[model samples]
Target: MRKIIFLGALIGLIAFSCARLDSFLFNPYKTDEYKLDAYDGKLQFRLGPEFDIPQDKIHLFSISSQGYKIWGIYIGDTTTISSDTVILYCHGNTGHIDYYWQRAKLLAHVGGKLRYGVLIFDYRGYGKSEGEPSEEAIYEDTKAMMQWLKDKGLTGDRLVIYGYSMGTAPATYWSSHDGPLTPRWLILEAPFASAELMVQDGAYFVLPKQYVTDLEINNAEWIKNAKAPLLLFHGTEDKLLALDPHGKTVFDNHPGPKQAVFVEGATHSDVPVILGIEAYISEIYNFIKSH
Candidate 1:
């Protein structure tokens, strides 16, 4: 009995340690409602009146992922989803859709007004979504969204997968893996290399990423397998993930047709604003057309 008790205690200790490390990785929070324009005071750039989306085009919906109801905002009419090229926006480790609303709005106006459909969502524990955020849960949540889009007649050729910061893990995972859908284009903005690199950067020493969390988020390795045309955006002055070990590392490891725009004086969240709205949109538009 004593031996069995000792083994159980050891297993409990390891699980506790893993849980502590997970807290450092995911930063999801609860919000009563997504107040797109009036919430969060952290937005550095806000769109003008001309950039406002028509009420008829905006959609707020939810779908099931691993028994959890994942919420999303689709910035176009459902009828257009079958024909228009859509962007499945996997947001960073921030709050929720409200936080990334401006970015999604910008994507809606990429080539012209409502030229491309944009879908941004709250991962399972963020905002009004159900359940907690785990490494696997986020991946499943993303897959669920893809299934929802597929049901709407969205084809793989019209799908563009865009990931920012922590969202890069799921974006790269789906791109690299043989799944139900493959992205027509993969766009990564300020991506971190891997969970291992993240843990090392935080501790200032090399350590096994599993010691902190069991997440298999390795963008550097996954990008090697992604064949879709890639467009990478990184800021030279990004202090959050840095240019060398994070963005550059992932960009270099990609073994396919890729284009990168290393913006000057832009930080992690300021890439779009610093790159200038017109130049940023033009780059994405031209890349999508050429590829």
Candidate 2:
């Protein structure tokens, strides 16, 4: 009986220690500086392939925000027509903008087919952008990007926001808020319900969600209030995101024109390919046309 009691106490202590460490890692304040440093190196090494399009065709610029600088790649008709619509892409969490070059190429190709501009950027700390990545910082960065685009004359009525994976937070938050610049359409790929729930499900594996701090970007709450047209894409066999409940939760709660496509036999990273790139583009084009 004494041995059993001692073993129980030991187990409790171990669990407590783990929980404490998880909380530390999740704490935005504690992780910010370190993450910022890491982002700098990542950005440097991940520069996108150099394409020599006419200066008028592509514009590369950086926007300054509190504690960060966001880098962007703008591709569109230089003619600057007043009624031109554009797609602003918020890429998934990963290395940098260069990693998304292929996707950008695809967007430009499809944008040409659909006759819309496509602008994609690296979040602060992810690509050539400066600063560390945090939930709040990403939200602010996205707002800055939108403002920069709007200042160039793109308005909400002519804008579509695409959020992939972790990018969903800021995209959803902006859409939900009562603001002057709401996107005409919002697209989420493999979106999780909430940061808290995402962590709770052991998605990261390395660290539990409970350990993270500043779980401010709750999509489930935000999606309930969003008014823009929404489209969700998730893989049926997504092991990384646990597709069913999270994706379903968002789809059900969203109060707007919405569609969800489940790619059969698709894992987290392969949904776009499995769905067929051409078909995917067509679906998006059709959705935009109908809405």
Candidate 3:
């Protein structure tokens, strides 16, 4: 009995140590100097004259959030309508919204052609936003920005949310719980199954598929409660996020009018273009129009 007890204690200690290491590696509260550097890189990318969209076509705005200022661009033929359908774009992890200048142009063209407005903002710790990046902080920032839009009189059906990569977390979280001001549509590109699964997959080649944690941002759960139409885009060849299963998982679980586009030969970063940008924009335009 003493030997069994000893073995039991040893197993408990091992489990505790593993848990500590996991917390250290995947601590949501942890911020690094590298994140600051990434923020600076975003600023350099955004402020240069090349990053500026044609001022004649797009209106630029800045809003204050806790310890940060979010800079965003609004694009449309503002003269057309006082209240237009607005797309709030939450971009991926790597770079700022400025990095998507071309994509913005395409989206703006679609918005102009389709008679909607487009707004894309950089998260705090990115571009002109003035703080560190954290899961909760980004969610608050998105909420603040959304409120700013609503304060300007945009309503649920007129507001669409688009998220790419890490952006999907905040978008999903906000869409799931942000009381009366729900978005009309939710678009997720290359979304992960959950944060915990992402970390597990990063640590081990394959996530075990059963472990549960509070830290997980289960888009699956959020989607079930989401009232908005959801459109997902994934690349069949995306190795980083594993398109087929993860994207399919979210699509299957989402309980709303939904569509998924799998780009044939594209990777995670290029699916937007490879799927035919025109068609992608048209899909969004059509979705907005139909709803």
Best by TM-score: 1
The whole-model lDDT of each prediction reads 0.89, 0.71, 0.69
Clash-forming residue pairs, model 3: none
Task: Evaluate residue 233 in candidate 1 and report its C-alpha lDDT on the 0 to 100 scale.
Answer: 96
Which candidate comes out best when scored by lDDT? 1
Among all windows of 10 consecutive residues in model 3, the one with the lowest summed lDDT is 28-37
Assess candidate 2 and give its lDDT: 0.71
Residue-by-residue lDDT tens digits, candidate 2, 154-223: 7798888888777887788888885547998998888888767777666536454556644655788899
TM-score of 2: 0.78
**Which candidate do you rate higher for TM-score, 1 or 3?**
1
The segments of candidate 1 whose C-alpha lies over 4 angstroms from its true place after superposition are 1-19
Candidates ranked by lDDT: 1, 2, 3
Looking at model 1, the pairs that clash are: none
User: What TM-score fits each model?
Assistant: 0.92, 0.78, 0.76
Across 71-185, the per-residue lDDT of candidate 3 in tens digits comes to 7767764454237777778877766665655555556655445356777777776766667666666687788878777777788877888888777877777778865369988
Model 2 segments more than 4 A misplaced: 1-56, 78-82, 111-114, 203-212
CA shift of 153, model 1, Å: 0.2
